[model samples]
Target: MKRIRASVIQPLLPDDDVAERHGWTSVEDPFDTELDHEKVFFNEYLTLAMRVDRWVVPGPLLKAHLREAEEKLLEKKSLERLGRKAKADLKVMVLKKLRRQLVPVTKSYDLVWNVNDGVAFFFSHSNKTHELVQELFERTFKLRLLVESPGTAADRRGLVAEEQRAFAALEATSLATMEVAS
Candidate 1:
């Protein structure tokens, strides 16, 4: 079974570094796919974008096609049913044929890295999206990032022990379920 992989990547600032390997074009003008030093290399901040293309085949569509292909195979071989290996081969062949007629679904996300400051930001609300960027960043730069949240950020900036205790003891408040006196 396929799983969704994602992350939020932070750069390990080492004076100067850039992601140049397997340079994929941004989700902008296809013809103008430029990743130049001037455009990419901002001494303090690196603004980047990623475009991921994925082939999503519908389960029902695949089942229908596979069933039709199986029937044809059985009819051709004059067999009651296909063997396990034959079914697997047919599935692979069917997927390849279907893939040719299908366009990949593309998703784009932007990331801003502040090398001077020990922080980076990926402009996506989705946890999955954040993970994807992180995975990409790790692969490209060979660096893992620590997840930053309200508590983590506070701890990093050394918010006193008393406040840290308060942060740890804090309960999640749902605004929708709360009484708002306007």
Candidate 2:
């Protein structure tokens, strides 16, 4: 039986804007193997690196929630002085609980299966699996899959020209008002 392997190279954090700036690209290379070796390797190397580098919590939603929690706690303290120390302690406790619930933000996986053809399949571990896979695909391909075609080059050029004209007009107006009483 022919063997197929699926490997994914994803950023520890979903955003990873620095990676994009550094021209880091994710690519999946599938190869054919004769051995029927079902292997699963879970190395803590990547996770450790991510934790050290602070590349966790790549999504804005999670960050926003954290910020909201902090804001609420601050507001509550500012509004009332009754049992202020206790309130502060409770807030700390709540924050700690939320941190624990915050999922490990950086993770990637590789699945090597002994199968025929290049079709890669896997069981759904969670409802977020599909979304996560799609996110990985976008990062790996560096291509956004949109329903319709985006703006053309000419359109972009036109927009740039309009912006330049607006800027030039503003500059001229500002310069014209300079008083030169000599």
Candidate 3:
């Protein structure tokens, strides 16, 4: 499911900082995408992008393991060994079986970096996935990431003195109305 989307940004660190960035290398086979790391450059800025792929075993699949554990626990001699430790060990066995039998669901995220602007965007709306990207980028490049929201983008747009003053004077208002009973 493609949900998380973000705008591009300038690089917070210098080009020199990117050198020896543990895993920073040219992207390969972007596959029908505009982000081609091997050849494309926009106005002297580096176009950096990559795909992060993961395998997630479905919850239902794992839940089935719990059911198996319960069934195993209820079996004749197994019922006598149904202590906490035994149940936990049984669950582990079921998990091992499930792991062997099922194929993990695959998911991929595409991230693009606007090197000149210190901005990067990832195609994910999930908070957990966003954190994963944030940590991965920081760990790989040794640089901090500032996730740009719409409000932050507007702030970065450089408003004029008078416009900034006007914006500051604005107050919050409720957009919801409650119906009153007659």
Candidate 4:
């Protein structure tokens, strides 16, 4: 059992097609590989997890390669004789080679969804992971994720009858004051 550090609840809009869909549907991974996408099911709590795989090269290793390439070019002639474009091209080539040697870095997060309330509880607090999850969720369900907090949940949740009328009747007023200390 993981403790949820932060949570976001989004109300599913009425008429969304997902309401009609049943059972778990796996979402395609946009990053890479042919591994089957994780499944998302309609249940008391729908648990979703996404694994992000990225090939990352070490900065120091990349820099060393670039420096070595530059030095070899210099040994061939004069460093001052090398054109800016030629130097840039060499650097780009070295970096590309270094990048090719990189191994994948995989990150995964488990998300629990409450279909009844249209709320999603992400197990992690990392904003990067959350953004990825939101994107994946929307793409998988063809629905939007509206972040819900205590202060904004009421307004975000669809207004009902009297609440809708009250919302429509409300007028906006600036809370800021023009008066300033001399």
The candidate maximizing TM-score is 1
Model 3 scores worst on lDDT over the 10 consecutive residues at 1-10
The collision pairs in model 1 are 6-131, 6-132, 7-130, 7-131, 7-132, 7-134, 8-134, 9-134
lDDT of 4 by residue, 87-123 (tens): 7888667756665555445455666788787777876
User: What are the lDDT scores of the predictions, listed in order?
Assistant: 0.62, 0.36, 0.52, 0.56
Candidate 2 displacement at residue 60 in angstroms:
24
For residue 71, model 1's alpha carbon misses the true position, in angstroms, by 0.9
- Candidate 3 per-residue C-alpha lDDT over 44-126 given as tens digits, one digit per residue, 9 for 90 to 100: 44444444323344688778768766776688565644678877767566555655554433244556677777777677788
Score residue 173 of candidate 1 by CA lDDT. 83
Clashing residue pairs for model 3? 4-124, 4-125, 9-117, 9-118, 9-119, 10-116, 10-117, 10-118, 10-119, 11-118
Q: Where does candidate 2 stray beyond 4 Å?
A: 1-78, 81-117, 142-182
Model 1 score (lDDT): 0.62
Could you give the candidate ranking by lDDT, starting with the highest?
1, 4, 3, 2
Task: Estimate the TM-score of every prediction.
Answer: 0.68, 0.24, 0.54, 0.56
What's the CA RMSD for each of the models?
A: 9.9, 17.1, 10.7, 12.1
Q: Compared with the true structure, what per-residue lDDT tens digits does model 2 show for residues 1-182?
A: 11112222232333333322111111121121122322222232111000111233335755566566666866877853336575565545544454454533333233222223222343334445444544543454444422212344334455677766654465323444436743
* Candidate number achieving the greatest lDDT relative to the actual structure: 1
lDDT per residue for candidate 1 within 1-182, as digits (tens), equals 00111222222121212211122333233222455545444788765676555566688998999999999989999999888999998987887677667765555666667878758777678886667777777766667755788767789978888988888899988667436643
Q: Which residue ranges in model 1 land beyond 4 Å of their true spot?
A: 1-24, 27-34, 159-182
Model 3 residue-pair collision total? 10
lDDT of 1 at 52: 58
